[model samples]
Target: MENGKLDTRALIQTGVFTALYVVVLAVFGQLGALIPILQVMGPFYIPMVCGIPFMLFAARVRAFGQITIMGILAGALVFLTGQSWVVLALAVVLAPAADLIARAGRYRRFPLTLAAYVVFSEMLIGMVVPLFFMRGDFIARISQRHDDAWVNALVNLTPTWMFWVMIAMIAAGAAIGALLGRTLVAKHFRPAGLVT
Candidate 1:
């Protein structure tokens, strides 16, 4: 295929992936907003495991720039749909980071490199961004208002927790995504003669 045609195809694929991400996140966000217990774990949507498929698709098409586009689209969708704007900004910032990690992995050494990616990704989204955007007063108020169980849980699952809960959630999501990516790649992508 010509370069322009290839780029068009990649763009379409990325758009589809980003739309799927936004839909999934919106569903989870609704769930989290409605249910108190679900809100505690926050439905694990922030780390954006949806991006894993996009990253793999980028690797297949050798269209790394699509990652940036996917990030922007997904972030915009989230903001438009009422997710925190801070998270939208953070997604834009973190998308390139994810692309770099995916590039380094080359879709090989899935366990180690992908685990590192998930860890850093979760830290950036779940820990650092929140620490920057969320007010100390807000956190303190939440801590004060809630029982020690809730406060301790949040603290234990976050920065001091090395953001493990977020990591675990992303890892779980990514594992599923990777499995799906493998099958999809083998079927639609690999046969297209794209750059795996």
Candidate 2:
């Protein structure tokens, strides 16, 4: 990018990849909403599915801020989907850290990019923030969308202690997702010369 600022091409790429990431997140997120079991397991699978687009985006990143932009859009997407603002807040914090991690590698080192994505993926923890920090409000907000019985069932299914478990799951999923994305990039993108 010229003058260390993202130009039109980078912004356009950010938009396209962010849109892909949002679509992927929304589709999987809805599955969790429809199925409590899936919701419980969301920390594991959602990040994994999102890896493809994220890795593709990472491949195209020529300057800083692209990952952060995607993270902000992702946060906004979650907010638009009726989640608390915590997601957005976490994005503000975590996305920049991720951006720095990638910048350390000049966005060309695969391992650093993978680590950045894992960190970026942790922003999803905001989804669970309310469960621990704002339980009453979380329940109140969720109750509006789901029946009390379903809400109760979900609450019962996810104990407060499980928050830590969810964090671990998110981390594991992010690692796997990054590896899977790396593999795909190697197998397909590299051969196709889509990324170097």
Candidate 3:
């Protein structure tokens, strides 16, 4: 970043990654629509699938703001798609924290990058926040947007204790995703010299 701002290339890269991340999120999110159980299990697998693009983005990050920008844009997109404001709020908090952590590792150290990803992935917990904190509002809102069957299924699948379980799943999924991402980066990007 020159003069404390992202230049043209970084902006373009951010746009590309942000778009990809949102697309991935949308695609996986649709699976939840088709199979309501996946919605309850989303915290575990969504991060695993999204890790490829994010780690690839992290590999390319040479500055501070890119990941944060991507996260905000992606979070906004998710919010636009009918999720809670908590998602955006968490994105604002987690993205910068992730960026800072990755920066501390110079964006290459495996363990730090993994930790950053784990933290970043937690932004998704916002999706489930309403379930715990605002069940009445969430059910009312969700029922308006979806069929009764889907909403009922989601509500049935998500017990109060499942919140903590989802958190643990996000952590495990993020770590597994980080390993997968690191492996792909090593096997594919490094060999092709796409990222160093």
Which prediction has the highest TM-score against the true structure?
2
Clash totals in order: 0, 0, 0
By lDDT, is 1 or 2 better?
Answer: 2
Error of 3 at 89 (Å): 0.7
- Higher-TM-score candidate of 1 and 2: 2
Model 2 score (lDDT):
0.88
Q: Write the per-residue lDDT of candidate 1 for residues 1-196, one digit (tens) a residue.
A: 1123337777888777667766665666566544445654542544344544543554544455565666667777766764456656776676667666655655354553355345333422432345334647546766666676766565554553544555566666555555555566667777887544
Provide the lowest-lDDT 10-residue window in model 3: 1-10
Q: Candidate 2 — which residues are off by over 4 angstroms?
A: 1-5
Q: Give candidate 1's total backbone clashes.
A: 0
> Candidate 3 lDDT, tens digit per residue, 1-196?
1223577888898899889888988898789877887887788889998888888888888578898998898889999998888999999999999989988887878899899999999999998899888999889987998999888888888889999999999999888888888889888987998786
1-196 per-residue lDDT for model 2 (tens digits): 2135687888898999999999999899889989888999999999998998898788878678889988998899889988878899999999999999988888878889889988999889898889877999888988988998889889998888899999999988988998888889889988998885
TM for candidate 1 is 0.59
Runs off by more than 4 Å, candidate 1: 1-6, 43-60, 112-196
Q: State model 1's lDDT.
A: 0.55
